[model samples]
Each structure stands twice: as structure tokens, then as C-alpha cells.
Target: MDNLTHGLLGLAIGALRRPDGQRAPAPGQGPRLDGPGLRWTSPTDRAVLFGCVLAAELPDLDGFLPAADPVLQALQTHRGLTHALVFAPVWALCATGIARLIYRRARSRPVFSYSLASVLFAHLLTDLWTGWGTRILLPISDQRYSLDWAAVIDPFFTLPLLAGALWALARKRSWRRSLLVGLTIAAAYMGFRVGSREILVRRVERAYPAATRVEVFPALLSALSWRYAAILPEGYSLGRVSIFGPVEPVRTQDLPAELPERAADNPTVAEALVWARVPHVSIQEREGGVLEVRVADLRYNMGGEPTLQFVVLVGPQGETLEARLERGGTIGEVYRRWKDDRRGALPAEGGAG
Candidate 1:
């Protein structure tokens, strides 16, 4: 999500339902730091900041999942099981519990369950339109859905109104006026998103000429433009250029999935896991096996680099998406430059005791 989006989300939440505004103290002033795991704070302001940042970044927590054997990582950060609806409530509840305990010690009012839920909902909704899909329902079942009505980033969708939101809060405008301004902006975006999707659908149908059964979603984070991906009888492919907006739909292609020479857990597997895109969507064999991982990245070249494709994954039998991980120590000593960098990768299995 954009920083501006995060900031606006935070401010809107604070103004709309903060005790500092008019709402009754729901509970202790609770934890305000961002990110998952335990968090705590003493002051209302800090708590609000916590609420805001958490609301902003909560959708991306699944990016932290470890890769399975024969790793399949994608550059798409938010397209994973972590974005699933089922996982969200559990994560939120756990975080809320931590806040409740911490606020108990500080004797501050814990944030209302309402506020927490509000933020979570906002996070999910914000990501719902982008090209990268989010699986809101996971574990109950692997059901992935999206509107695909916006680009990876959008200027028309958020800029002017988000700017107004900041101005309203900074100048201390009445809550109603500020909220109205924000809502108007949001409403306009929704309208544009619809129109954009319609245009892409028409163009896509023309491209295929005889295509049947199409699915299109605007890439999340994109402003008004959309990224259209569809499944054909042969295979799946992204649509052509936006023709109106800044987006360029990726053309579909058929590629071969080259399995890792050895589909066993190790550092190479970890490398692939980071690229898997989904934090929770990985192979976990009870007695050593493989998984069908689907990876999508525009940069992949099948006959050339073996990566940079729209969908890439591996399985016990064959390839779902053409995917494989090549080793890299570090790039200019910027990342993965040390042993500890691997700490964030999924824990390795089949290690020595």
C-alpha cells in the first residue's frame, strides 16, 4: 500500500472514532506500534499511531512466509494466502489480546474491537482492486477473488482526496467535513474503477476475438488503469496495453517449469520461498514430496532466464507455473549480505539435530 494511503487511513480512523475525538473509551489506550507480534503503548496518540500503521500494513504480513522445497518466489508482494480473510481475524485477535494485556498494565483504555476491525476491513478493501490477487478465504478453502479494476498504483483514485484528508487533519477541520472529503474521494475512485474495468473487458474480448470465459481485475495500488489476466483454452495470459491509462497488460505465453534438481529443503529452497509471493502458500510434505506453486512475474523469460513470467510454480508431478530459484549472495552488499538476512526466510526443514 502507498504511504499516503496508510497515512490517510490512519488519520481518517483517528478522526472518525478516536476517544480524542468523541467516542467513549472502548478499553485501554493499547499498543500503537506497527507490524505483527506483541505491541504496547502508554499514550492515546501513540496508540492511535499503532492503530493507523497496523491498519495500513496489516495486509502484507504474509510476505514473511518461508518457501517450500523447490522454492517458487514472485516479486508480487501481496499475492498470497496471508491476505486470506480467515487468517486476518485470527491475527487481529491475537494482536488485540496483546494490546488488552499491555493496556491493563498501563491502565489505559484498550482500543475498541470496532476500531481494530475497521482498520482490518479498510486494509483488505484497499488491496481488493489491484492486479495481484488476494485470497480472502483461506483454510476454509483456497478461494481467491478480486475486482482487478485498478493498476498496481493509482493517482486519480487517491491523490487529490488523500491530499485533502491530510490538509483537513492538519488544519483541524470539523470531523464531518474531513470525513466527507475523504469519502467523496473514495467514491470517485470506485466509479473510475468500474469504468476502467469495463473498457478493459471490451478491449480484451476483441483481442481474443473468440475468447470465452474471461476474468479481469484491476491491479491493486494502480490508480484508474487495470491489469487484465484471463484463462484461455490453451493457457492464461495478461491483456494488451492499457490503450487509455498508463498500464500495459501482459501478454500470455506458454512456458516450461524446470523443477529444482533436488526437491528437498535447504538454503536454495529458502531463496525460492522468498520469491513465492504468498507467505503461507508453500509445500509442506508430511513425508517428503513436492508442491504445485504458481508464480507470476513480468520479468520471467522461459527459454532465456527461466524466470520473469506471469505464472511460475512447481509440483511433484509437473509444473503449474514455470518457476525456479537461482542463488544470489547479495546485490552490492545491500540485501542478503549477511547470514542473519536468511532469518526472515521460512525456517529450513530436514536439518541436522
Candidate 2:
């Protein structure tokens, strides 16, 4: 999910924490201080809001970490250690310490710490709801988990949360009620998406009885449209299905289930395979005995072409010449390096087995 949506959720959490009878003042107007030594007792003080927003977005801070490979950086680092459940308390403690220093008399340490930890947990849970995988249990296991209920960037999910946050920030009373309504709507929306995906999955399964496995992913922009991969004995079929339009797949393509040793053995390719859920390999013979191997995850496909892909250029002697990650491009742009006459061709059955 995007940072803006995360921040809005943080704002909503902060609003919920606001103490009774405490009215939120206009922007730039500080919270009303009470008690001896001018202690800031407001639970919805600046420190609390800062802590909430920070905790909400802190998991994504792993993106700053450096890595040798772009694919590893994106797949392993961005949502890796920081997003783990075990690290949530550690992150909360660190955030609380910072908030305490910034606002010395904001509130009780336990209150702030608990609120921060809750927000952090919410952030992780929200990430899990999206199609993009999240490594919730890092030290225990590196396996990425996802519900595939919503797209990473969904306005339908974010708008309600945003409206609640804005209402809470702008209104002096009944803010929590508004936030609750917004959260309820968002939860119901996710339920609808989950139910719709299940219906689509069942329909695909019934349509392709021979399929051994059927996986459905939420498409961008709308929940009604989904991308599915049905694994069969010979190969896998990838397609798009519209829940409202028809129970069957609107667009479908069959792809062979083969991974070449030369491509898979490459260090970069190996790292990407770890993260790819439904991989599609395209090997094209280019000029001067060069091989352009493109490995893409069907889960990230848009308009029939994959946006998240890894490309490896191999020399005639099977030596890796170039290895890089490609993101967000049309089919032509992604395969522009290959000649127009060339097409993706798999090697002999056992040649690259």
C-alpha cells in the first residue's frame, strides 16, 4: 500500500485515541495543556499523533536498506525485517522513545507505547490484506503471506479511511464515531472483495476441472476484475476475469511450465524466483548469439504483460552478460531489446532441464 493511505490510517488511530471532552483545535493551534508544571495530558497530543503516524509507516522504512541486486532489494528488503511481527515491539519502543524526547509531557509512557504498537500491528495487517506479499514472521520464517483481497493501491479502500482521518482532524466532536464508520466501511469493502474472489475462483475451477491448482489475484483499480492462474498437468493458464461481467475468464493464455537451468542458475534469477508466486519465463535469442531471458510473475501482469520482471542477458557461451530488474512497462517496451521477428521459445524438453 502507498504511504499516504498508511498515514491516513495513522491519523484515524490517533483520532480514536483522543480523550473524552477534549476538542481538537484548528491546525497550528496546539493542544490545551493542563495540570501542574504545565504537563501536556492530552492523549491526542502532537506526540501521540506523531507516534501513530510514524509507527504506521515505520515498517516500510526498510526500503532505505541497500542491496546488491534490485530484485532482492525489492522482494527481500522492503517488507522484510521491519514488517515482522517480532520486531513490532522493538519498533514501537524506539518510536516511543523518540516521541518522549520530542514531547516530554505528552502522556503516560505506557499509553503512548501501547498506541504505537497497535498502529504498527494495524499497518502489518493492512499490508497483508493486499495482493503484495508481507513477511509477517521474519525470523521464524521468510515465507511471504498475503490474502490477495485487495490491490496494493486501491482508492476504494483508502478513500473511506482518508475521509475519516480528515473528518477527525477537522471536526471537534463526534470524530471517533466518524472514524469508526469509515473503518467499518473499509472492512466491509474488504469482505466484499474476498467474497468476489472466492466466487471467481470457484467459477474458474468449475470451468477448468483438469486444473490442479487455481490462484486468483486482485487487479488494480477495481475489485470486480481479477487475474487468475490455473495450473494444469502440461502447463499453466493465465487470464483475467470480471466478476460482474461473466463468471468465465475474459482473457486467457496458456504458458509452458519450464525453467531453464541457465536462467534459473543465475544468482539474480534465483533471488527473484524466491519472491515470484506465478513465474512466466520468456527466452529470446537475440543478435550475435546472445540470449535474452525474461522472467516475470504472472501475478503482477497488467493488460496481458507483466510489470514486475527480471531480465538476464546471456552470451553465446552461457555467461551472464547483464542482469537487471524491469518494472512497469508495456509488452513492447519490456521486449524491445529483442528483434520483431523473434519470439519466446523454450529449449528442448531435457536440454535445459
Candidate 3:
């Protein structure tokens, strides 16, 4: 989701995890193993509120790393290996050490390390759902793990949490209770999403009895919603259709083809080619280059926005190519479905045989 929701969740986690107190627990007393520390359970103080926000938001700074993303060049510039899982503990420790030294002057308060850790952990968990995934084991290994479930900007996922946090802030009441309510709502929304996908799948199957394969997901970044694409024969040329609130659903055909090289033949393709200006737009035989190419309406996607998008194979000569795209949650799945359909469309049929 967005920062606001994460901030609230971070705050909630902070509040619940800490101990109930207006005064700091003795240094040796330490917080309960599962309890929040100092500012977490204290009567609502403006500084504590601010600290909660900071604790939640600060860790996301690493979302912009150089080697972190493929299609999105910006991540490569920021949010690097420092944000990985293995690094999370080390990062928190370093941060706590720094805060311990720097904020020792605060006579009546404990350090801010607890809150910092809360925000960092929240950031990592939020990233676990997006398409790009997170590298929790950074220094150990640069592998990425993601649920491939939630979109980057799910409203259902974001709003409830934000509302709960706001309510907590405004009432000066139970931040813990409010946090639980909001997170519960967010969890329910996730359930709704899975149910909604099943609904879409059943509906699409009923509509297109011939659909050999079908896949559905909410539009990338669209919370608690979904989009669908199906593969059949030529009658239904690769198309994208949106399912907004269950009203008869609308469809749009004209999905972009995958082959960037094919654009050389169809000037129409050239006219629409985005990122063509980029140096690496040419075809490359990547690891999983065994597929067709197609362009998706990735404008709504976080990083891969362009008018003239490119795809892998399905070029003029039907060449094998690589996917140089950084995918958001939704459209990437569409591309995968489209590629699956083209397995039978090679220059010579039954090539797989």
C-alpha cells in the first residue's frame, strides 16, 4: 500500500508492542519480550505520535536501490541491499546504537530504537506483497521473496488502516485497539480480494465457455478490485477487460504485442513504442526467453509507465527474446497469460513437439 497506511500500522505495532507507562521502565527492567517499549504505551504524547510516524516511514527509504529493480530504474538509485532481511536486524541494531548515543540527553525518555524497528519491519512486510518482492537475505544472498498477492496501492488495504490511525490520533484513546481494528479490516479486505478473484474467474468462465485458460487479478495498484484476461482461439484476440463493481463487465481488445523486433515491420508498432529510446530495447536471449511478446497498459503501474511499451518474442521473424520489464502485480500476470497462449502460434506449428 502507501506510506500513510504503513505509518499507521507501524504506529499500532509500536503502541501494542510497548508497555503501558507514563515513565520509562528501568534500563534493566527492559520491555516484555513481546511488549512495546517507552513511547509505545505512554499516554498519547505528540512526540510519541510523531515518533510512531517516523518509525513506520523511515525504513522505506531503501525502496529505491540500484540493483533492486529491473524495469524500474529508480529503485537501482536508492533502497539498495541495506533494506534486505539479513540487513534489517543489522540495520536496526546500527540505528538503535546511533539513537542511543545521540539521544542520551533526553532525561525522561527511553531511546527511539524500538519505534525505528517497528517502522522498518512494517516496510518490509508491506513490500512482501508487491510484484517486485523483497530481498530479506541481502548480505547473505540477494534472493527476493514476495507473495504475488496484493497490488502496490490497494485502497481497501490502505484506507481502513489510515482511518483507524487517524481516529486513534484524534481521540487520544486506545491506539492499540484502533490499530487492531484497522489491521483486522485490512486482513478482511485481503480475504475479499481472494474471494473476488474467484468470483471473476467463475464469471469469465461462464461468459467464455471456450476459454482454454483464464487468469484474474485486481489492476496493479487497485485495492480490492480486479481485472481479467483469457486465452482462447483467434476469435478473442488477446484482450484486457476490467471488472469494476460487478456490473456486466467491460472489455478492451488491443493488448500490445510482445515482439519489439516486430515493430520494425509494423510501423504502427514503432509509433507506439515506448522506451524505444532506451539503449537496451533490443532483443536478448535471456534465461526464460522462450515466450511471445506483448505490451500491457502499465501506465497505472508504479515504475513501468510508457506509451510505447515493448515485449519479448513474437517479433517479425518469431525470434526468442528476453523480458526486460519490471512488473507491478496485475499486468505482469496478464503478460504471463498472453505468453502461455502463444505456445501454439510459432512460425511452424507444434514446435514444442
Candidate 4:
């Protein structure tokens, strides 16, 4: 999920409950974060509201950490250690301490702790719904888990939360009601998507009875449509599934089950093989006899092309010249130059000039 959606969810949560553990005041009779004639009546309320928003957006800070390889960096950063379930309590405590310092109210400690923890866990849960996957059980397990129920950015899912948050910010008396309705709608939408995915999977299985393995991925911008990949005895079957339509494959390709021999020597390719859910390997001969090996994950794609791809350039003698991960764009000149430099450094007997 994006930061805007997370912040809006935090805003709704903060307005629905009071930080001092007291029940929220009746409509038109409480401290409001905004709107005319409203003033800051409770410092604890302000502290808790901001604390929840900060906690909700804090886990993504792991993206700043560094890694030697782009593939490893992607796997270990972004949704890495900070988003782990075991570290939520620690993060919540830190957020609570900060809130206390800012508000100077020791009495709000328990409230801040509870609210912050809730927002942190909510962040992790929302990320898990997207196809990118999240390492919720990090340290204990580096495996990334995902539901594939929603796209990373789903306007349909975020609209309700946005409306509710706007209502709260507008200082409407019935803000709590709006937020509750929004949350309920959002939950229902998720349930519908999950059911749709299950139905689509079953239909595809029936269609391809010979498939050894079948998996469905959430398609971009539509809950009713999905992309699927099936492992058949001969090769792989790739296609799109429409809940209301037929289960016809888009295309079929003969992809190797393992990385190509030329790319196996590259460390980045090895790491990508482990990280990719449905690995698709392709070999192309580039200019000057360079072997361009592309290992892509078909789970995430746009316009029928893999969005997350790892590229490795191999020399004639099978030495790895350049290895890097491409998120969604074409290979840049920097990569070309890097490969040229590596090729230039090779021994005279290794390959042609």
C-alpha cells in the first residue's frame, strides 16, 4: 500500500478513539484536528493522532538501508526487518516514547503504546495483500508472503478510506460513522476479491487438469481479472483469468525449470532464482557476441511483460560481465558500459575483442 492510504487509515483510527482511554465525545462536542471554530482542547489527542500516522508510515524507512546487489537489496530492504511482526512492539514503544516527549503527558503512555502498535501491525497486514510480498516474520523467516488479493495501488480499495479521512479532517460531527462505514466497505471489498481469486483458481485448475502446479496473481486495476501461470509437463502455460469469462491461456512458452547454464555463474541471477515466484528465463545474443540472460518473475507484470526482471550479460567464454536487476524499465546505458568494462578486463584468451 502507498503512504497516503496508510496515513488516511491512521487518521480514521485516531479520530475513532481517544488517547486518554476515555470514550469519544458525542457528535459536535470534541476536539477536532481541523475545521472552523475548533481548537486544540486536548494535547493527548493531538499526540496520539500524529503518533499513529507516524507509526503507520515508519516501516518503509528500511528502504534507506544499503545492499551490495540490487536483487539482495530488494529482498532485504523496503519491506524487510522493520516490517517484521517481532519488531512491532519495539517500534511501538519507540513511537510511544516520542509521543510522550512531544506531549509531556505521562498519563497517555498506555494509550499511545496501544494505538501505535495497532497502526504498525495494520501497515504489515496491508502490505501482505499486495503481490510484491512482505517479510512479516523476518529474522525467524526470510520468506515473503502475499495474498495476491489486491494490487499495490488500488484506487477502488483506497477511495473509502480517503473519503472517511477527509470527513474527519473536515471536522464533521459524524466522522466516526463515516470512518466505520469506510472500513466495513473496505473489508467487504477484500473479501470479494479473495472469493474471486479462489473461484478463478478452481476454474483454471479444471481447465488445465494436466498442470502440475497452478498459481494466480492479481491483475492491475481489476479485482475481477487475474493473471495465471501453470507448470505443465512439457513447458509453462501463462494466461489471464476473468471471473465472469472463460479460462483461456494468453500464450505458452517453453521455459527452463532452472537458470540457464551461462547465467548460473552470476551471483545476482542465483539470488533472483530464489526470490522469483514464477521464474521465466530467456537468452538473447547481443552485439559483439555478448549473451544477455534475462530471468524474470511472471507474477508481477504489466501489458503481458514481466515487471521485475534480472539481467546478466555473459562473455563468449561464459564469464559473467554484468549482472543487475531491472524493476520495470529498459536496461540503461550505465549497465551497457559496466558490461563493456568487465569484458574489456577479461584475459586475451577468454574471448574475442
- What value does the lDDT take at residue 86 in candidate 4? 84
Candidate 2 off by > 4 Å: 18-45, 108-120, 250-257, 285-291, 314-321, 330-353
lDDT of each: 0.46, 0.69, 0.48, 0.70
lDDT of 1 by residue, 1-353 (tens): 45466446545654444434333325564332221322332345445444544655555655565544223333333445666665566545544455455544322334444335544545666666554445566656544556665554566656755766767557543433565477567667678667866877777776666555455554323454344444556544544335474434343444224435543333334343443332112233322355533333422211111122222343454423235544332344323322222222322221101
**Candidates ranked, most accurate by lDDT first:** 4, 2, 3, 1
Candidate 4, superposed: residue stretches over 4 Å from native? 15-41, 106-108, 257-262, 284-291, 313-323, 327-353
Estimate, for each residue in 217-333, the C-alpha lDDT of model 3 and write its tens digit. Answer: 445445544545555553221223334644232322333334444434443223224322111133334344333434433322211222233353433354323334534336676
lDDT of 2 by residue, 1-353 (tens): 88887877775676555452345546555543321223234533667667777778777878889976666677777888888888888777776777777878766565466556545645887888777778988889979999888878899988998888778557535556677678778778888988898898898898789999888898767657787888777666666677875544333445633656766576666767766677677778789977777777778865445677788786766677877787855657645522211222222222111
TM-score of 3: 0.53
- Candidate 4, 1-353: lDDT as tens digits: 88887776766666556433235456866554333444444667667767777777777777788876566677666788888888777667766777778878644665466556555645887888888788888899978888888888887888988887777557554555677677767778888998999999899899999999888988766758788888788766777788898885655656554545666766666667766777777777789878787778778654335667877787776676776777765557434433543233321221101
TM per prediction: 0.54, 0.79, 0.53, 0.79
Q: List pairs with backbone clashes in candidate 4.
A: none
Highest-lDDT candidate = 4
Tell me the TM-score of model 1: 0.54
Model 4 C-alpha lDDT versus the unseen true structure: 0.70
Q: Residue 274 deviation, candidate 3, in Å?
A: 17
